[model samples]
Target: MDDLTGGGAPDSTGAPLLDVFMQGTTFFDMVLTGLPSQPVPGTEIHAEGMGSCPGGIANLAIAASRLGLRTGLASTFGDDVYGDFLWRTLEQEGVDLTRSQRVADWHSPVTVSLAVHRDRAMVTHAHSSPVPLAGLVSDTPITRIGFVSLDEEPEPWVSRAKAKGAKLFGDVGWDPSGRWAPEELTGLGDLHAFLPNSTEAMAYTRTEDPRAALMSLAELVPVVVVTCGGQGSIGIDSLTSEEEWVPSLPVNAVDATGAGDVFDAAFILGTLREWPLRNRMAFGNLCAALSVQQVGGSLAAPGWGDLADWLAGVRHAAAAGSRSAAVLANSYGFVADELPSHPAVSLRRAVATIARMSDA
Candidate 1:
């Protein structure tokens, strides 16, 4: 990859052809846990667990890296203590930071999350804005798949990346404006896949039905997927006029943060392996469910061992000829026959690494 850091061309250091190059915000997240209830004014609440680590797109990059994908990140960071922590954490995770920038006199974005019950509430402050997309992709070698948001106007960089044969994957955030303007999707016409939650897709398309939303978005992009939290996800391919729906896997969720990002990473993995769209959504759902059963967003992401264990259970059920298991087998057939026995990092090691990074 072309070196955006001016250090040199990115060394082979096991870096693949920029499998997933993400451009977005990165946060330094400080987590507080074991709270009995929400805090009141002038009250002191303590937690059993407290630590910090990288957040935002770093979650996605870490999730993809754990899944054994070659990942690169392009975003700006403040030249502060928090930025130093984030940089060290990501580098230890083996993520490529050649495209990242550290700006002077700025404070890195930070989020303080309070964990209650099975969810969390977060407060964030960002002191530095992201580097423009054009500058990020200017002379750098584009990854096979480039991820960006369509929340704003179509940027010239989208077409520039596509011109170099990179497939674009588009996602969006909540429209606080509530206008949910359709023109916001104007950039998707040049994208290869559009992935959004049911609410965002429905609101943007002005349709309450998920299938309708999927089909509507399919008109603008070749591939459209609408993730419906518990109802599962819906996908359609305009090229073949094919549609698929995958039900969500049942799991006791401890934290739903970063589940969507993990799902995106897994779905992109499926796409890279040429798995059928149905399987992609199923895999995404399974991985997302596994993630929610843990704490924190990025920290909760599953590793290869987690996936293998889950697959082992599914295969055991499939061996008993269970109907639901049979259906899952059809979708996850690759796992039984092709998945590796070990993960790049085991859960124990991942946790230990997080602990180390948090303390740093």
Candidate 2:
């Protein structure tokens, strides 16, 4: 991993790469403890701690900057202590937050993250949900940044950016019917690329299979990119004759937070370079593979140089690992939900099925 602060790393071709600018919000993380177990009712949990950085749009900006683009983060925050920390962290990540502002007496958005083994639970308080800015667009001269991602909220500049021929992209995080205030969420159609995870896709389309959900989503958007943890990911590239499937890279798993975000960033990079679907998927898989090796989200993200080097070295073993991931994804999704129900779901049964396939 490279320094969290600004630093340069030479790419495979031997050139120094630096952080770029991007704009977005600073989150107030209220992460909880007691992972690998369900939350007990009436249990008292603490904020535990807090960290600051450009999240959402800001995260995408920091990643783009790290890969050597001058990225800028434009978002809103209150004049609270956390807001101040957010600005500093963005600067540290080399994200240009010049356009972001500190509103007086406004509270920043906060989310409580809970871990239950491989699954994660989050409860959010979006205090700055109704962020309003006079000038939300930028006239600043930024180089060709074809990739853009949004966590939530709509920036009119995004549409203008697309009109200027910049590639616009984003992930539809999630909007639960029963719980979430769905009106606050935005519809995901009309994007150069629309990335959504299995959960979100299912919720939107009301389907269990990822393929069916993606196909349904394609009616609204040209390209529907769906991210599945172990199954890797797939996207419909209409530019080509048919859809493309990108396989996942194998890794010793740990934390799953930010894996989807990392994958989205990698996909954008691969698309900008016009890599083949396979290579694009490989880049995303490798990015995700490295992410789970460490704890937390951003901390686990590998520097581009380190990741490229790592990929260059792995060969057939990696492919086999991907097949393993596919087998798991196909049989039981990415989670271990079968063990408790021996009648249908069990890792042992899944393994036996896999063994039979291999043996045959």
What TM-score would every model get versus the actual structure?
0.84, 0.70
The residue pairs in collision within model 1 are: none
| Shift in Å, residue 265, candidate 1 | 0.6
The global Cα lDDT (0 to 1) of model 2 is 0.55
In model 2, where do residues sit more than 4 Å from their true spots? 1-24, 30-34, 42-54, 129-135, 138-153, 179-189, 312-360
Best by lDDT: 1
Worst 10 residues of 1 by lDDT: 1-10
Instruction: List where candidate 1 sits over 4 angstroms from the true fold.
Output: 1-16, 31-51, 114-120, 130-134, 153-156, 316-331, 341-344, 347-360
Q: What is the lDDT of residue 268 in candidate 1?
A: 85
